[model samples]
Every structure is written in structure tokens, then in C-alpha cells.
Target: MSRAEVKQLIGVKDVARIVLGWGAFAALLILHPLLEPPVPAPVLVIALAVIVAVILVCAFGVVTQAEALAHRLGDPYGSLVLTLSIVLIEVILISAVMLGPGEHATIARDSVMAVAMIILNLVIGLALLLGGMRHRGMAHNRTGTSAYLSMLVVLVALAFGLPALIGVDGSYATAQEIPIIILTLVLYAFFLFRQMGAQAGDFTEVDTRSPQRSPREERTGIRQVLAAHRAEVIVRLALLVVTVIPIVLLSHDMAALLDDGLGRLGAPVALAGVLIAGIVFLPESITAVRAALGGEVQRVVNLCHGALVSTVGLTIPAVLVIGIATGQTVVLAESPANLLMLGVTLLLSVTTFAAKRVTAMHGAAHLVTFAIYVVVLFS
Candidate 1:
């Protein structure tokens, strides 16, 4: 094979994912005796690093491969593919960790909140800043952003706020959590029907237009386009499974390390949530940033808001169900400070996206908010 052909056949991302997954898995298994109680603090730290690295690599591989498939599918569908892929990864990883050998009542809450923070502030701010530098400012679909925010505000309240208000015990009662889960599902389902079905055009367009892709992505796109439908379907289906297993496997080890590491250092419990959020958000974060740089502010909006909404929408229900199945008490309530941050975030999203255009000033505001979130996380 020519060098180019060889490169195509031997995917660095794919191979890295496989190696990291197996390596992490094998390491964890082999070190199980050492990993038991009184485990050296250094060993725990090293385990944390290796497992998180493996999971992160697999995540990026999943995103890269999914983006290629999304390219073939096209928007609405393409965007759906991307958002759902990230949600699936989050669900798998979170579920794995939650089901593992410890209690993690707040993983879902922290992760969803982290996603909301990342989406509304960091991703949006960076996108606006980067897109402005590239194209002097970018325009987004106000209608979709407005609608998304409308649902987002309500959903955030329902998921994170409602629990604190009505719960009987320290956390929510099954009674309270179940209702919130149902409400979130119904609202999100309606939003999907409207966006993907009734008035899909109101949403922003994805800019996977050929001219924007890299030479390799372009060639892959061409191959995807020319391939028989059956072959393409088989490839995507196969790749999806291969990419996800590693993340699910590594999540437990990563969770144990985070719990151990944070506990050892006397860090705030919320820090664990931030780490979970960052890891799960990394894959989608890349695509959103790329969309912003490509001058597709609308796609960036879709990616950011879609992720925020879906993280709340899908995750709440999934977490609730997991709680029911496992007898785990899932807590969605944020601390007072975090609740304030969320309120500010939702409020700002309402006003920022109320307009049709976004600029550097908007990006700066977002970055400032993101800085506050980080500061609070550390403090």
C-alpha cells in the first residue's frame, strides 16, 4: 500500500483507543491486589492518571469517528448523531462508575451541572471569541437559541432545584425524583419534536460543507459517500461499539481514583463532579469549538445548547432509573453557591442569545463567568 493508503488503514486514533482501553483494563486487573485497601497513595494517583487518560483517548476516538459518520448523515440528523453520541458516552461512563463498588450520589448532578457550565460559558465564550477573530463576529439562530433556553431554564430548575425544595430526607425521596424524571422526559421529547420535526429550519445549520473539512476527513467523506449503503451502515455500527466499550470499562477505576484522591486531599466533593463533567464534555467540546471556528455560530449554539439540554434531559431520567434499580439515592441539588452560578448562567443565556448576532464582548462576558466557576471550584 502507498503511504497514504497505509495511513488510512492504520488509524492512530482507533489504535490508540484500543491500546489504551486494553492497557487500562489489564493494568487495573493485574494491580487488583495492590489496588485493595491501604493501597499506596502514589499507586492510587498513578491509577487515576492512567484510567482517565485511557477514557479520554477513547472519548476523542469516538468523537472523531462519530463526526465522520455525522458528516455522511447531514444536519438535524448529523447534529443528533453528535449530541446523542456524547450523551451515550456520558451515560455509559457515569452509569459504570455509579454501579461500581462505591456510593456516588452526586456524579450525575455534578456532571450535568459541569456540562451546563462548560456549554454556556467556556464553549460559548471561546467560540464567540475564536469565531470573531476568524470572521469578525458570527451570527446564530435566535429562534432556536431562545427556544432552547426556554426549555433549559425550566429543565435546570426541575432537575437541580426541585429536589432541594420538596425532598423529605437529605436527598430527594423516590417520589420526588421520579416525578422530576418524568417531567424532564416529557419536556425534552416535546422540544425534540419541535426542533427535529415541526420547524427544524428554525435551528442553526451545521457547516460540514466540504470546503471546511481537512484533506483526510474530505477523503474519508468521499469514501463514505461512495460506499454502498450496507457497507457504510456496517462500518458505523461496528465502529461505534468498538469505540464505546473502553470508556465504560475505565469509568469505574477513574471514579474510584477521583473519590480516593479528592478525599485524600480534603477537596470539595464538587471537584469530583467538575472532573467528571470535563472528561465527558471533552469530546463534544472539540466539535463545538471547531464549529465556532468554522464560522458556524448556529451550529455552535446547537452543539452547546443541545448538549446542555440533553445532559439535563437524558441524564436526569437515566440517573433516576439507575437509582431505582440499584437502591442508590441520587441527589440533584446543588450547593447554594452553585445554584447561584446556575441561575446566573441560565439568566445570561436568556439575554445573550436573545439577539441574532454574537461578538467579542459577549465572549468576554462568558469567559468571565467561566473564570468564576473555576475559582469557586478550586475554593
Candidate 2:
């Protein structure tokens, strides 16, 4: 390959990310014995920090490539790729935590709840606040946003609330688990079909009064752009997979270290869930904020709302299957307090998206709810 081809395939920063990600994974494999229990406090702390930093780097790399793919695919499909990639990371982390050496029956529940609170309340709150302050009120597609929320309400209720109401000891029976898993997957599949098919237009920004470009023109533009960058798409997709593999392989080590470190420090168990959610969503959170600030309110909505939907939709079934297969108890129900918080968050989300334009006040309301979630988490 020519130098320019090599350069396009992997930039200097991409090289750094690949090296750090895979290098960390290789080092962890070689040094696995040292990470065992009774290690020195300093060593444990250093290991945790290094693993987290590497994971973050790999995560950012994944986001960069996913964004490139999203730009190529356009709107709902592009957003789907981005959200699914992040959600894939989330599933890996959650699975690592659950399968790691611990009685973490509730890790899945805690993580899913954390993702919802973080994305719906915290991330969206900040995006709306910043975007609204600059633009007075940010406009988004009410139809698409509403569809996302409608699915979220049912899925959240089924995954979190209904389990508490019906399951014995905060978990479903084997029979119940199979049906619920199928239901969640089927619902999400149907939603994806509509979002990408007949209702695809609902996900994009459209100014009916003063149109910028016709649908045909927009389609032509996307095609031309995709054609121009076909080679880049292939390169980025390859890199995205390369970058993600390290994070997946390294996650088990990270999980072991995190469990040990947090146990030593006597931190709240839920804090692990929060950290996982934060790590998994950090890149997407930043992207959403930038999109909001750039006046792409619908893009912000797609990123934030779409992420949580994907999180709950995909993570629950995954953990449940793992639990069934491994004989681990996976908890899906939330505590009374968390359930109440989840209810409030869902209701608040409906209200926020019901409007044609979102303002700072809407953002403030969501932030207040998120603040309460944090307080509840620590207390």
C-alpha cells in the first residue's frame, strides 16, 4: 500500500490507541498472577487506573470510527451504528462484572438503571441546557423522540418494574426469563424496522416552512459522500473492530481489579455500576453534547435516548441468558427507591419530548432528577 493509503488506514493517534489498548491487554495476560488477591494497595490502584485509561482510549477510538461509519450511513442508520457499538461495549463490561469472581447478582440491574439515569437525566439534561442557552430552544423530531420514549417506557417497565412485582426474590423464573427475552428482542427489532424504514424521515430534522434541501437532494448528497469515502469506511471499520477487541479481552482483568479495589476501599457496590456506565457512555455523551451545541437537537435526541433504549433492550436479555447458562442469579428488579426514580425519569422523559421545542427549563428538571438519583445512589 502507498504511504497515503497507510496514513488513511491508521493515523498517529490511532496507532497510539491501538498500541495502548492491545499492549495493556497483553501485559494484563502476562501479569495476571499479580492481580490476584492480597496485592499491595498501591499496586492495585495503579493497575486500576491504567486499565481504565486504556479502556477509555479504546472507547474513544471506537467512537471515532463509529462516527465515521455513521457519517457514511446517515441519520437513523448511522445513529444506530454508533449506539449499537457503545451498547456492545456496555454489554461486555456488564458481562465481565457479572461473570467475574463475586456475588454480583444485581450488577446488571444496577448498570442498566445507572445508564438510564445517566443518559436520560444527566446527559440529556446537560445537552438540552447547553443547547437551549445558545439557541433559546432546540427543536427535535417529536415523532421519533416519542417513539423512542414509548418503547422505553414499556421496556423499562418490563425489565425493571415488572420483575419486582412478579419475580420471586428480585428475579424471574426460567420460564418467565425466556418469554421476556423474546419480547424485548422482538419489540426492539420492530422499532428498528420502522425507524429505518417508513418512519426514517421522522428521525431527521425537517423544516416544513423553509426547506433547505429536498429529500431527493439529501439522498443524492449522502450517496455522493458515501461513494467518495468508500475506502475510508472500510479502513475505519477494520480499525473499529481492532480497537474494540482489546477492550473486550481486557474487560475481565479490569473487572477483577475493580472488584478487588472497590472491596478494599469499601465503596458502594452500586458505584461499580455507575463507573461502568460512565466509562461506556463517556464518548457518546461528549458527542451528544457537541451535537446539541451545534444545533443538531435531533441528533442529540438520537444519541441520548437511543443509547438508553439500546442499553436496556440489549443488556437485560444478555445478562439473563448468562445467568441461566452459568447458574448465576441475575437480578432484574430495582429497589423501591430506584423503581420510583425510574418511574419519575420515564415520566419526565415523556414530558420533555412531548414538546415541539426543548428549553433550559426542561433540562433543569431532568438535572434535578439526576441529582436525586446520585444522592440516592450514595446514601
Best of the candidates, TM-score: 2
Evaluate model 2: give its TM-score.
0.87
TM-score against native, each model: 0.81, 0.87
Tens-place lDDT digits, model 2, residues 1-379: 4578969768889989999998998899899898888778899889878888898888888878777777677787667767877688768777876787879898778778888989999999999999999999888888889999999999999999888888989899998999999999999989977776667777886466875554566566657866887677667777877887777566545766777777777877677767666666776787788778888889888888888888888899999988998998888888899999999999999988889899989999999999998889778
Which parts of model 2 have CA positions greater than 4 angstroms off? 1-3, 92-104, 206-229, 245-252, 260-266, 325-328
Task: Write candidate 1's Cα lDDT for 103-174 as tens digits.
Answer: 888878877888788789988888888887888867676776788888888988887887777874436787
Poorly placed runs, candidate 1 (over 4 Å): 1-16, 36-59, 92-102, 173-175, 206-230, 262-266, 322-328
* lDDT against true structure, model 2: 0.82
lDDT of 1 at 204: 41
Q: What is the lDDT of residue 78 in candidate 2?
A: 69
Scanning candidate 1 in windows of ten residues, the lowest lDDT window is 206-215
**lDDT scores for all predictions?**
0.74, 0.82
